[model samples]
Structures are given as C-alpha cells and as structure tokens.
Target: MWPNPTIPLRIKLSGTPREIGLEHGRQLACQIRKQIEIYNTMFKETSKLDWPTVRDIANEYRVTIERLTPDIYAEIAGIANGAELDILDIVALNCRSEIALGLFSDGCSSLGWKFKDRTLLAQNWDWTASIKDNLVIMSISQQDKPAIHMVTEAGIIGKIGFNSSSVGTCLNAIRARPTDPKKLPVHVALRVCLNSTSAALAIAQLEALGSLASAQHILIADSEGPVGLELSPMGDVYLKPNDHGMICHTNHFIQNRFVDEPPWLSGSPIRLDRMRRLASALVADGETVTREALRKKIFSDTFNAPQSICCQEDPLRPLPTRSSTLFCIVMRFAPSTRPTAQIVWGKPGSGEGDVIIMP
Candidate 1:
C-alpha cells in the first residue's frame, strides 16, 4: 500500500498550558522521538555539536525561559512529562535555533501581501526532508491568550502559525550568530508572538525581552498589515511593505547589513528577486492578488532547480543534508472573520499533494 502524501498529524487541545502540552506530548510521542533523532544527527553533522552538548546549552536557557514566559515553560514541562522525555531534551528541541546559532542551511521564502479587503501571509518551509513525518498541525486554546493554529515540528511548541486575533507569523532562518542565552529562544519567541493579540503587541513583547536569542526573520501580519522583523542579538530592524503593499523575505537580512549572512544559500538572492518579479506581474494594473493566484504564480515556480523558490532535494547531496520544500502554508486574515491557514503537505505547485485547512 502507498503511504499518504498528506502526512502531517492534526490535533486539538484546550485548558491550562500543561494540559495542552501533555496532550501534545502523549499523542505525538512517536513523531517527537523521531524529531529528536533527526535533530541529534543534524546537530552533529551541521554544527559539530553532540546531543549532550546541545542539551547542556539548552539547559542554560531554562531559567531564563521560565522567568520570562512561565506559561510556555509549563507547557514545555508538560510535553516532557507526557512524552516521557527529559525536560532538557524538549528544551533543546525548542531551542534548536539558539543552540545551533544559525549554523544550518535552512532556507524558506515568505511573503505578506495586503489585498483591498483582507491580508495574506504565505511561505514555503524548506528544510531537510528527514523530519517530514514529524510535522504537526496544532489547534490550541488557553484562557486569556488568543487561540493558535500552527504547523510545527512535533517536539516544538512554536512555529509558523496564526491565532484567533487575526495575527499570523512566518519564519526564515538567517545564517548569522552569537546566540544569547539570556533571551528567548527563536521558537519560544514565535509562540509568544502567536499568543499576542496584534502584530504590534507581539513586536513589543519580543523587544521587551531584548529580542530573540539568534538571528531570524519573522514576518508578522495582522488585519491592519504586515511587518517584517529582522531580529538579531546585535540589533533589530523592521521592514514595512513596499508601496505596492507587498513584503517579501528569504533567508538573509535586508536592512541590517552589519550582520554577516554566510553563503549558506546562494540561491536566496535569486529566489528573492524571482518573488518580486512574479508578484509584480501578478498584481500589475492593480490586479487583486488572491491565494490561488499566489499558488500558481509564485510558490509553484521552479526557477533555479533544487534551489529555486519551490525547493527540491539534490540527489548528489547526502540524504541528511539534502533539503526540499516540505510544506507550503497560505494564511488569510481579515477583520470581520476568523483567521484560517491553508497548508499543502508537499510542494505547492507540484500537483501532487493534499490540502489541510486549519480551524
């Protein structure tokens, strides 16, 4: 029998942070373990760090995380208990960005476009295909916080997601470093942003914590509009949409040139330019850009093969290092209705995948 292409596991949880997390842990235990093994090997191969060293680094952030965001910390503790894994292990998974310090060649393309009536945020999550099965879509509800629906690695709590408040976020990993243990880990920061009621509030929360632990580009959007926040330990820069009301970002820092962006993905520039041109073509003459238009014109483009906007694995590379577009998510946010995410399990334009909508 053939395996299903739409492989992401979906689950819903409500109540206290711990309860929500415990359900996440217990239900996705198999995928969580697989995620650990994948990350363990990836850490050693990409950053020359062993699992023990990674856990040690993750341990350093525990106190700071607990003090800064106790609710998320409690959730992490619950996930640990439910998964029957050490809290340090779960912490390491959540803090993978800080621990690795942008050492890996993870590439993604994100854009936020404002239509006349509604706004859209979309991205192609490109990374090693080894953990494809570890992805999950989580619908979480808490007492005071906005409800969240996000797609994340099984063991991670935060990632690309939108909340009940019409605020959505997309991430792009930058290959620049000097991570700070005192700050919130990248994933933790993502969760915090999803918990906020608005994009501005999310930015304020991250700024209050002194920015994220490492270098990253988080494209945050709400009913009003979108803002591209280039966060780093050195400083932070925000990129507003162009006059065309389009914001595009790949894996490099655009405004902050002081921070060195290694040549991890040489195709990044090519992909970025491609998106602008494609977007312009789609919206020329004030044409309204819709989700289907984006799906056909942008995310589906296979311009520079293997490294194009629609990334594909290079067979010449080893299985562990090869990367591809694991999933593509298109989110719609409007003032009058609830937020929703339309996700494709595989490459978007490939004509070979299934769509899953988030509630």
Candidate 2:
C-alpha cells in the first residue's frame, strides 16, 4: 500500500519499454487511477477546463510524441493497457504541465553545486498536497539508456531523478508560453535528459528535439558540472554556474527574454534569493556542500511564511489551489561511481519525515 505517511512506495522496473510500463501499470494501478482523479480536479480548478477538454488538448500532442519518441509512446501504451484507462488519460497526465500553462500555483526550488570530489543537486517539490499518496520512487533499467532512479508521479515517465551515468536533473515549471504541441512535452523531455550519458549530451538531445513544448527550467548536472537550461517555445537560455560553481532556480524565468505570467506563485523570486543565499553561505568558507548541508541550510528554511523556501499551504487560496512542499530530494554525483539520492518523504526539517536512500 502507498501513501503510508512515512515512506513512498519504491518499485523496480526492467526489460523492454512496454514490459517495464506494463509492470509499472499493473503494480500501481490503484495509484494511477487516483492520480487521474487528482489531476482531473486540478485541471478543472487551475485551467478552468474539464477533463474531456483537457484530454482533447493532450491528444493533440499524441502524433508528435509517438513520432519523436516511439519507445516512450509504446511504454505509454503499455501503461494504459495495464491500467485499463484510455491512452489519452495517461497522455494527459504526462502533458499536464503543457495543459496547465503554468496557471497552477505549484512551484519548486532547485539548486546545484559542483565540488572537487562530487556535485550536489537538490530540490523542494512544492505543489498541492492532494496527490502526495500518488508519489513513487522508480528504479528503471532499460536495454540502451542508463538505468534511471527518479521520484515521479505514478503515471509520468520522467521527473526529478538521476541516472547510472551520474547524470541528474531538477525541474522548475515556468509560467510563460506559446506552447508548441508539436515539440516534446515537458515530462517527456525529462525522460530524454535522464536517458543521456552526460549533461552535455542531455542538452544536445533536448536541442535535437527542437523547441520545448512550454516554458520550463531544467537544472542538469553530471560529474562535469551543473547548467540551468531555461527553455521556452520562443527560445532557450543556458544559465551557467557562478564563479563558485553553484546555480539555483525557482518558478519564474531568470532571464528577461521570455514573458512570464504575473508572479503567480509570488514566492518564486523570494525563494530563489533565499536559496542562493543559503547555498552560497554553505560554500562561502570553501566548505563542500553536502547532502546534510543542503537538507539543513537550503531546503528546510521557512523564511517568508507560506511563501518561503520550505513552502507552506496558503489557506487564503482555495483548497484545490493551496500549495506546499510535498517532498525534498538531495543527490550526490561523482566520477566513475553511481549517483546516490536522499529523499525526505515529507517536508524536509519538518521533524515529521522519513528519509529514504536510493541504491
């Protein structure tokens, strides 16, 4: 059973794309259905569009997804078959970011610091708590790509995670776009990044896919270092680390080119500053930022109340719109060794949390 309140369900997947997706669908059918329900409510409330309309929008991306990444589409088909849900429903979940258009209040804070021995990447995934139970940790093994270990919603193929090649990524949903449905969807882009052998290769793959579907930030890091890739349908910007080898991002775009929605989350700028300050302080004395340092100094801070780094639900908003830090993950990447992660199933430093370590 999942949503245990202490630990997230962990599942291992292997073999062909369809087989892995089938096992994922079969083992977590209940969670998958629940995710649909949650997203249905969220879509209606946030996008002002009912499930049927959302499905239609999701279907528009079908041809593009299948044409660009047939293997992923096959896996999606397997998931739909195994879950006994329409393929469109599963597709909608994967395309939620594009459909929502960054209208949702959900926001996340992500940072990466490269060290002499290893690089540290971390993030606090802030969103409505309604779907907490649907969260799962997946260890996926495929024939050609590096094995992936990620924490994603039940039906999404990609999200925040690292790979056997020591490559990892963090996502910040930006509220700006003239989305090109013909391009790669956000979550699918995440899967492509996770499948890469290095940060440089990941960027190359994302570039080859053409313009991203919507506005988003993907913090990609490997043993070589971290780069903040701010992607918009209009264009792309690469945010390199500071002189100290550190970078951080929140909901809003750091660069000025792309237009963004009125600071929808409001905390976007505040959290970004706090994150940089906290992360800079840790490494100011030339101290290597460790997972513990990130967990303590960066992700746990609640500086501006409901809008702080460790975000809290704003009761002023409607129940469907309220948001909070659902989970926190910190990962370490080093040369010639498998990357590792430490996940706090609940809000980090909230005292009521279970920390899980990945293999």
Scored by CA lDDT, what does every candidate get? 0.89, 0.88
The estimated TM-scores of all candidates read 0.97, 0.97
Question: What digit string (tens of lDDT, one per residue) describes model 1 on residues 230-325?
Answer: 998889999999988899999888897656666778889999999999999987756668777788889988999888899988898667778899
Best by lDDT: 1
Alpha carbon deviation, residue 273, candidate 2 (Å): 1.1
lDDT of 2 by residue, 138-245 (tens): 999999989999999999999999999999999998888688899889899999999999999999988988958988899999988899999988789999999888
User: In model 1, how many backbone clashes occur?
Assistant: 0
| lDDT minimum window of 10 residues, candidate 1 | 1-10
Cα error of candidate 2 at position 209, Å: 0.8
Report clashes for each candidate as comma-separated counts: 0, 0
